[model samples]
Target: MRNARFEGKVAVITGGSGGIGAAVARRLASEGAAVAIGYRGNKDAADALVDELAANGGRAIAVQADAADAEQTQALIDRVVTEFGRLDVLVSCAGIEHFDALENITPDDFDRVFAVNTRGQLFAVQHAAAHMGAGGRIVLTSSVSASKAFFGHTLYAASKAAVEAMVLNLSAELGEKGITINAIAPGGTATAMAVEYGAGYLHPELAGKTSLSDWLKTQVALKRLAEPSEVAAGYAFLASDDAAYMTGRTLQYDGGMF
Candidate 1:
């Protein structure tokens, strides 16, 4: 069941090899958009996804860029436009998690989180919007932690909160250009990152053998963690014509945070 909602459109998803990012890439591609998967280091995964999408009859490419680097982020967009000749949507899903309290939080940690989750996303939009036309859409990924006060989430939440704020302000300016900016705030989701939660915290590269499947179920009204595809559905709506009139607001994909 493919839709032509995104036919002829081109989208670039940062952190495109991650669970949620990959899902968004597939979703947009399946709906008729030429997709670009941006990865910081996971070239293999990014390339594999591109191949899979192409095999499935979608146009895709893989590019390397660190989300935290402004120059690299700009280059990622430039390369995308070079490949597809147009930019219709930009989704920033590249983020990192650090579980430290105020006592343990350091400047480096704060900077890393904000650099990728907040600042990097801003620059990505800056580059994308310049190439976009009247019907452009920008969707940034914010986390439910931004509003939930989750344990060990001070830095992460603060960074994501900035994204929601960005959407609000960017809406007016982008709207003037006939483009839209919005966010998708997902609750505890079943992504590869959650596998790190088994270590008693969320974030890749942490010590863990446990997953969030059981623990996260208690955090939301829904009894299970959301799948990457479920979060992608929300992103798809924001990036499509269905939400053309919507801007400056976040589609809360949270499973009723409790």
Candidate 2:
């Protein structure tokens, strides 16, 4: 049976058009939350997911909201509240990856990654907190690169590390509001974004050993990359009552990478 942990709750998933975000949407909606898919672009994808969820008897909608912009992030939360008359969970899965060597990194690279991955989540939670009464949950997405060493993750890793900082540092602050903030660090999820940018993180030695698709499995004890749904399960836990006492920490779901 689908859990009713989120019954009568409202959620806005920024980057809901993407792989991980879409999976999170499906997970939350299945658990009985009314979901609004806030996407910067790709209306087609977002709309399709909303339709699928609705057809399955879930309440869902697709909306345009740019996560990188604080004002827009604020708008998304407010819009969901207006549409559903309540706000409860915020799962920020909107982030970009930029991998480059020390010499090849650019200032723009730093700006874009942090803008969406860090600054965006800060404001989203900031806005969402203002509306949630109590028992509100915030789940920000981090990456394995933030906690461990990964080749060419100079920019991307730093961006996510900032997110980790927020999760750790803001717990006390959010606790005052009867809310909890946490994060999830997914290792290597089999998402389109992963396949698209995974190669850019390759150092010469790893690239020389094998193709990205094959080499990735060797790094994980599970011998495979995680499905986006697996990562979504992590998000669901943080957003549900089960994690009510859990905060100021990150759930690392990286397929036992060492």
Candidate 3:
């Protein structure tokens, strides 16, 4: 494959301010794509990333938009088209995970998780589809929790499960347009969110017992957490022309964590 696989393309990545999203943005931009970083609140981080990309001879812009809001989501696509004059790739990486057991889950929490993880992804693809032509690639971020029964992830898993289903239906609907829609389901990754969720981290209370991180590692064949860049590489592949024949499938980059 060419080093500049994304050259002359334009990509919009939601939640590009940090974590897997930021890693994807950086990888795409480095490969010569004009990237628009969609951020909800952290303008500083977004601006800093844009500047860093520019400094490294990459074309990038930072846009402020909340993925949970339908209007803002549409506006995000519009802003990217206005700035870059086209949209070739859309990566819906904006998501929030609120872990609550079934008995403790709230209605608001359910709505919040679906608002960004599920609804946001749908609208992002719907609007981006309008601007994309042949060869457009859409990548959605999902999680292993979508299929695996994880503790305190009822709401989060449900939202991602919806995304996985949507990818299949949308692939059939959009295939004629030559647009490929797929998803990446990552396992325990070394991101700030992972730390907050007790992945690959030491907890004092669980010191004597089996820690969450230890238990998770043992479950994975790799026996380790995946790095953000490792997950981003999956996004890069799906967004590239090399993955043209693959669609409607959720690629699991979960360190063999089924």
TM-score per model over all chains? 0.93, 0.96, 0.95
Error at 29, model 3, angstroms: 0.7
Report model 2's TM-score to 2 decimal places. Answer: 0.96
Q: Model 2, range 73-97, lDDT digits (tens) per residue? A: 8888888988899899999999888
Q: Regarding TM-score, does 1 or 3 come out ahead?
A: 3
lDDT (CA) for every model shown? Answer: 0.89, 0.89, 0.91
**Candidate 3 lDDT tens digits, 1-258:** 548999999999999999999999999998999999999999999999999999989999999999999899899999999999999999989998776668998888888889999999999999999999999999998888888886667789899999999999999988989999999999888888887875323334554588666776668899888899999999999999999999999999999974
| Candidate with maximal lDDT | 3
Cα RMSD for candidates in order = 3.2, 1.2, 2.4
Residue 195, candidate 3: C-alpha displacement in angstroms: 0.7
What would the per-residue lDDT of candidate 1 be over residues 25-119, giving only the tens digit for each residue?
A: 99999999999999999999999999999999999999999999999999999999999999999999999887776899999898888999999
Q: Candidate 3: worst 10 consecutive residues by lDDT? A: 198-207
